[model samples]
Target: MTHTLVQDEAAIRALFTSLVEGMRERSPARVVARYADDAVTFTLAPPLLNAGLDARDPEAVAGWMAGFDGPITIEHRDLSVAVSGDLAFVHGLRRLAAVPVGYPEGFSMWTRITVGLARRDGQWLITHEHQSVPFYMDGSFLAATDLEP
Candidate 1:
């Protein structure tokens, strides 16, 4: 049982690592491999909205990734992951690069991201994600905006 748990954890970690790499490489196909067939993704970009997709559907995943010109770079830290049965959750900080010229400043904003994941068919996959920016004003972390719920 202990060995099985360890292996499970290792597998989940690998799945997440691969997803991160895929995002950096702008490979939606690779990223989609880490999601379940009916997984949903919610993005908080201005004009906040929710979008749903099927992970097993490669065409849909590829189409969504096509919206971006290239992969977005990310640096993750303080990552914590836990798995129970077929469910897992990961919370961490991510520094993302801004979109190129003519995009809004928000597009260039670097922010922190939190994500939820699940395991199916003995494989780990991302099921949901939430991202936020740490508001800073005059070099100090603005408690009100930065810590707003």
Candidate 2:
């Protein structure tokens, strides 16, 4: 496919790249910095709905990062970024790879991701983000975490 991102789309892509960098670094401040003050997020964790940056709370994010043994790497796949005016959204898959503090064996999981962004004051900020994994349709409705892209 002949894909050439426009200026806005390029900027948004860069923003996502930086966000991933922050996540790998496990820096709460940097991780949350790309989001707007009232950005809503539905993470892989509990709570059906997160009203604002609650999902990206500095303390909560830091605690979660602490659960990992070392750096947390995120790889985005099948990414689709669309931009129109000041509103934009990205649909993609994110693979999180990390080793837990107590578990010597590392883990890697791919989750569906959707990120909504809006341009404010000539800057692009994440206004919403949702991440989830599919669930088995069998008798046991457990999350399908072992799937690969």
Top-lDDT structure, candidate number:
2
All candidates' lDDT scores? 0.63, 0.87
lDDT of 1 by residue, 1-149 (tens): 23366777788778767867987777777877776655555544433534455434567546555655555665666778777777777777766553543454434344566777776665677777777765556687662332311
TM-score of each: 0.65, 0.92
After the best TM-score superposition of candidate 2, give how far the Cα of residue 112 lies from its true spot, in angstroms.
Answer: 0.3
Cα lDDT, model 1, residue 52: 51
Q: What is the Å distance of residue 44 in model 2 from its true position?
A: 0.2
Question: Which lDDT tens digits does candidate 2 get at residues 1-149?
Answer: 23234988888888878878998878888888888888899888777777665855888889888888987998898889988888898999999999999997989999999999998888889989999999999979999998998
Which regions of candidate 2 are displaced past 4 Å?
1-5
Angstrom error of the Cα, residue 63, model 1: value is: 7.3
Tell me model 1's lDDT, rounded to 2 decimals.
0.63
